[model samples]
Target: MSGPVTLPAILARRAAATPHAEALVIDGVRVDYRTLHERVQSAAARMVAAGVQHGEHVGVLMGNSVDWVVLFYAAASIGAVTVPVNTRFKLDELNYCLKQGDVRVLFYVDTFLNIDYTQLLRDVEPAFDAALPGEVLPLLRRAVIVGDVAGHDARAIPAGVERFDALPDTPEWRAEAAARAQRVSPEDILLIQYTSGTTSFPKGVLLRHRNMLMNAAASALRIGVQPDDRYFSVRPFFHVAGTTMSLLVALVTGACLLSVPSFDVANVLTMLDEERCTLTSGNDTIFLMMMGHPEFRRERIHLRGGWAAAGPEIMQKIHDVMGVKYMVGAYGQSEASPNVVLNDWRDPLELRVAGWAAPHPGLEIRTVSQETGEVQPANAPGEIQVRGWSVMKGYYNKPQETAKAFSDDGWLRTGDLGVIDADGRMRMLGRLKDVFRVGGENVAPAEVEETLFSHPAVQLAQVVGVPDARLGEVAAAFVVLRPGTQASSEELIAWCKSRCANFKVPRYLQLVLSFDEIGMTGSSKVQKNKLRDYAIREFGLA
Candidate 1:
């Protein structure tokens, strides 16, 4: 069924069927399927001219933009792997992602946030010159900066990167890209999303074209997407939810996607009102932002359902307040191409928040003991194991970790604890590992603790998730400050924002005098549950 349903094929078929129909609207620019498909083809040809080979990783570092979508499909058109770099990544995080993904060609905004990405690279690797593909790093040969020549710093692009418009645009190049795009197969590896794990660094989840296409189709159908729906998207394109769910779903169903560079409450409300969008898909953070905004009550907008995982009360409030009856919740990780288990919009509100989700077609789920591989009885909680077509092949270049991720018979241990009833309805309990979700983004304790440990005044640090009213959960830190070093909680909290992603920054920090204040196991691992209890009492997080 997925043989010819590749990412490029989705766009091609959509363009053929609705050549003049609206395809994407972002940053005040509207593009139709015919024009969008043409630009994607042109960009693909540029990638070919730039020497991006099949299986080669192409890094995209930019905010949500029409160009970002163009570059993504362009890379897909030529069978080059598209590696979406997190725009929030600082120098260290960005450097690691580039190296880890082994990106050969990079496309980034010329000047963003007053700092040039290429200059940042040059600061780290002074030899980072890439006038052409494979120019500087071990695998990174070329850099393409997306910008208008008339823009500031256009003439001042740090050595070796070409302007976005400088790429070839002739009919000959377009034809070449068209021919090459035709050769891309559904089984080809299309995306490498770098997601952090409980371990220190992030791993590249290798998703084939079919894995993404089917996953998007299934999830959209499960959520009851209507063909005439206009989707409002605020999530970053780097995340699977943005591309696979928001962008691809619109294409799959002939829906129009209305996007913004980032979430602005005013802009979101404006889009919701102006576009009369039938649905809006993003994390809990977006829903919270919209509901909390001052103009929230003053606005009169009608829509269907899209927000998910907000517990029962909030879900009910959204249904009543937003007038979106079908908006529902969903669950899945990046390895499963994002969503294998999804909640039905038509189901009762209680069932949705209870995590009563139906697995996608061909997706198999089982609960098993984390210590022993024994399968648990119905409704018993342990680790949730999933396997099927949507599951990724493996982590790129990390065979050992990939092997450890699955069992001998090939069940992917999801590291999450959940219960499955006899009816096959699953209730997500919590994480078996210290990893937890904060505003829908995974926050591994180690990742947050590692950033805190870098502080000079911090002797030891442990992060645990605590209940919150707005965000479903937030990271709270228990810190053992150095005896002589005097540091305020505010200072340490501010320090964390610089080192880690904004979401991973601890919201509540407790300064303790000694080790006995924390519950530690005999082997010296901090008792994570006790920390959660302490957070509730000390910070009043609950």
Candidate 2:
């Protein structure tokens, strides 16, 4: 029970400890630990009956739901790698992901938000024969659909697709799945999570069961996760942040997840209060919406601790506006099981907010000069490199990219720039590739964006570098105002000029209506490359 923490082992331990505990509660559906365990077992058996072999890749393209959780754990238990695809992906994006991952079977909801997936699949590949591997997705042999597909409004499932509701969960299949689960190893590759690529194409990060489980256990303990804690699950399952930190952490700690499919401030606040959630995690945009909600003060929210990774300005505002005082700030990316620096739950609010994060146990962190490969002094920003038990195996099948990812001594160069403070806490500065030089001075967009957030008129601020004839590059600001609030480009420009250095001030400003206009990934990271293109076109800066 103590060594080699595997997914099946975690599931078994939790179910035995608290079989009747609430494991998942979402949209009028509640499932206890025992029920969840049984569902996962049945799903694993059904997958085997459908010809899913051990170590095969299974893709899940669905919104947040009980079934999505079941598929994830079931695949892990049976030694199959689960690829979490963004449900928001269009046909082309979906095809690219499925093909690149070499997914053998895909499970997707038939319809979500007015889009008919079955039709989309047929449209993408006109000759998609379900009985054989898909023409577009050459490895896909099975398409499992989960939705209301049997009633009057239901459409006929394409050939080779099976409705999950109609699949049999026989005792024989369950026994077979159990036998398969017994053979699953802790070191087996179980996840192929794609990084939300902002500047370049997404790469599949290969992760094993130990990478995920150990990170989950260590991170959960760092945040003081309790068995009865109600974690407000807002992050999507496709991202490591959602799975490693929220869902898997729940299984490790016996916590219950109050799932949120999308970010709706009113609904989130209502659910948080109704479910009596003790913890919630999100970035600044999410917490800002929560604080700006009309019912925030009235709800008298009951909470203890959660993860919030906005910079200093937004973190302070969250504490002031939302009374979210017991939150932790951390840093990481998908390749490191999504956790490198985690805040100790016992730290004071000031220490937690000011210091980005202290290193989690079993991980080594250092900021090394990019040019010399020498370690930087304290408070000097450099590329943050990590070596730890939780680091991923490698990028799936891309040997050259994988070779470039790690050093000869085995440390994974994170590509993120950071500074270790005098107190040994790490503060993320920005990405090394994201820095823009303004008149020979290095300008980190995050610094400018953080400054913009301090302005009362700005709700969300994203700064991107734009081409300038003389300066080589100048900063451009995209501002999203708070609800019912308005601001002018000239006004924000003047505000920046007053607060920031002349070179650091953004040269151009544009007001954006929504994040879609900014081209955000499903994980909520801003697509800066898209913003740069928009800035260039809008300003005629060619």
Candidate 3:
């Protein structure tokens, strides 16, 4: 914590302190810190040798693997900004990320049916074969393939395409890259994480090393993660919550990080038991999956603590069943380096209250009425606003959108509607955009959604406003049932009525196989806009 506290520095410090300890676990591959550090240094050297410079953007289009983590740390070591392109994204999404971040180099895994990087590059660069040798690619320069490259011919290599194996490990190169990395300031831009907005385009959330480190430090402190604690990370590294709060926090705190390529409930359960993982974090879906898992008996997993962001009932259920010693319920967004408010472990009631703002020294939180813009007193629901060190620099390249998120005084308008209680805890009511008028009575969908999740048959639920001539707007519930379990619409409606205010109950319930096709951002929050559109289209409310 002494010098310029960059990510590379943290990795280096951890490597120095515990070189032989396991740094990453993926696909049965265990990489010790010594090996992980060396791999990062070697990759950084290759990147520099390939002409990547400080402040330049390096696009990483790979799945959750050691290669992805290596490239991320490699870029950070050289002061190059890492842009983690979602592997699930199609060609259009990949192209947008490349253009939006102005990515100069791309490190990608070989093309799969789910994502065709070769086809995407072809679309981005039409004249690939005729380009001059050593010519810099404006859209994307170097295309380094992660796995085997035997089938890909020279013609398909484009101008500057390189294989990951071609990058050799050399001491001189490692020293030079490490020396360069040492100069990186905490204020330097570390990552650009894309989050989907109400529009079709995803916004690039810009986060600096300082912002991320501060947030991680705060989260680590909040969770009380000790050096001996082993934290499991099933959340993808591309997400702000997973990368900074989970992975980086482990690195900075001298803790072990056991990462999985994806969330397989059974695999996660096994790992929690096998690794003795003390901490974990995920959204409601993950918690529900764990609770519903056939083998999820309390005695099987030895979890000391973890964090969750879900409804109050789900939180209570997790507490009751999981035997998690310290579970924090958090709320935040990618724009604020993800964690703005979190329920403290000190009080179980804090989980029931609105999330408290992060222990960000300079951060401020306020509530203002949506209709009047008047500041609301304690317990009165209003729009939540925040200004803090943890806030992102801005949405990358979208000056207009960035401006819209802030007020004249520079407080970030969170777009979430909530109330600050007299005790200084802020309770989130729902998203301002998610609230609807039902027969002139304001209805918050989150209220209904949470109540529905508490239903024994409902595994996951989302509520949206569907147009009704009689009521102006009526609540519609889209539910995903517990595996092999089914509940009728009437039962669900009655369940909601029993738990919540009558006005909050859904008038119509749609038993769906899934919520929406829209994928999760690196963080596991539901893409509500996708759900809203699905409700409009499928229910004929549009």
Candidate 4:
């Protein structure tokens, strides 16, 4: 139970156990374990050939494809760490991650629409710009292009950029690479996942091979993944849920992974029916989209496994429609390997609750009142605290922020408001920081947002507390309607009044055509701070 469990070891074990099993299916291209192993080795060999050494950070900025997986394992095989950059990030944000990680090599797709790499690096730096055809990525000593860049000039290639497709396609190369990969150890740092800076600047979350292996084992236990299970992962692989649960869990269990590079409702529905995926999970918004899809039939979308952090109503809808055997509702942030709590899908009641903490084996959970600093009794709401092996090493390069997150005794302050029932089930009330005072009463925005989302015409809703003279603060709602849908502000206000307390109902309503300005983390959680700033600017609220 305590032996070294590194990424290379996991791949080697799977390859040895089920070499012929279909490991991945991307755009209908099936890659069996045997072939995957060979490719991983080849990729790793090529990295070594290009001078990638032990412990160097390699940045992977590619879409969800087979090559992405190959490059990831290749880096791991050579004792190099990988950083999966968010594809959705703007150029500046992407630049920050590359620099912070001190990436020595970068593997990226040729181009994504609206994201031109050639233009982005035009003014990057002299050393970075002057590097040979395979070396244009400044902080990045070497670069590999995954797809075709046929017409692009070699001199324009910056310094050290090379086409991955141009690598020598020889069996010897593959053999040598595979041999090198087998040497990686479990203690090596395999990944550096950057935090989704919702409240502050992003930080790299360093996860060692053992950290990933243990988390994957825990998740596999929690979700009960089978070898034959087909997982449809629409979430981007850079996020913890996608990397640990969607990708690693599927790989560890020898299940087939069907990745969707980006979430498109139509594409998801088609994939669900066509692939007959047995397990899938994402934010509540994803479940809502699937439920509201026109062709949504319980027999098709919900087959075996579904998990998310959602409200009670949505959980009921999933149960009623999908007939999912395990509709797990859980909560956790980026720091705790992102899978601290999960509800067993077998129990109907547990499915309705927030989630039960994962069997941490060595983790402790406690609830304490923020005001009195006293441990709360069972069923009493308070701030949740945890201490465990699963907690992050620390927020990269931010000791002050890391110190603030943990108590003197080492309990990680989760910043989540919850209650532990008599049976030890955790019910998430809301985020403590997100809670706002309205008329001197604390109001969790999630409560009002869920209520607003329950309305027939409401597609998405976000509630923010604004300054008010009489009540000290009042709720202001921003709503997005379904296509061709319309509802007056008065109607929405009245609906809120009928569903929740008078003070909880939003006094101001803003019907938006789209939520383009509202930035979302890689996992799809709304950036409420952005919305709050927009409200203050537009409405002139002090």
lDDT for model 2: 0.84
Candidate with more favorable, higher lDDT: 2 or 4: 2
User: Per-residue alpha-carbon lDDT of model 4 for 1-542, expressed as tens digits?
Assistant: 23358788788788888999889887667899989988887787788777788888988886778888888888888889899888877767776887778888888875655566655544443454556332334456666777766436655665556777676756675666666666777767778888788887688887777777677777776777889988887877788787787778877889988886667788888888888888888776887777776777776674687567787766666666566667678677778776677765565654453355443466567788999988899988899888877777776667888899898788888898988877776778788888888877989898898888878788778888888889988898898886667899899999989999988999888998656666667668778788888877778886
What are the runs in model 2 whose C-alpha is more than 4 Å off? 1-3, 127-130, 150-155
Best by lDDT: 2
Candidate 2 C-alpha lDDT tens digits along 1-542: 38458898889879988999999987667999999999899898889888889999999987788888999999988889999997777877777888899989888877766677777777665545346475676677878887676322455567667778777778888888899888999899979999988866689999999999888888888889999899987898889888998898888999998887777788888898888888888887787777766677734677777887788887787677767667888788999998899888788878777746888877989899977989889888889999989899999888999999998888999988899987778988888888888878888898999888888878888898888889989999988888777789998999889998999899998898777865888888788888888889988986
Can you give the TM-score per candidate against the true fold?
Answer: 0.80, 0.96, 0.93, 0.92
Question: Against the unseen true structure, what C-alpha lDDT does each candidate score?
Answer: 0.78, 0.84, 0.78, 0.76
Candidate 3 clash pair list: 354-426, 354-427
Give the per-residue lDDT digits (tens) of candidate 1, residues 313-352.
4455567666677777777788999886888777887777
Runs of candidate 1 exceeding 4 Å displacement: 1-3, 113-115, 129-136, 149-152, 197-199, 435-542
Worst 10 residues of 3 by lDDT: 128-137
Candidate 4 ranges with C-alpha deviation above 4 Å? 1-3, 126-128, 132-139, 150-156, 166-183, 353-359, 484-486
> After TM-score superposition, what is the CA distance of residue 413 in candidate 2 from its true location, in Å?
1.8
lDDT of candidate model 4 versus the reference: 0.76
* Clash pairs, model 1 backbone: 133-141, 134-141, 134-142, 135-141, 305-327, 306-327, 308-329
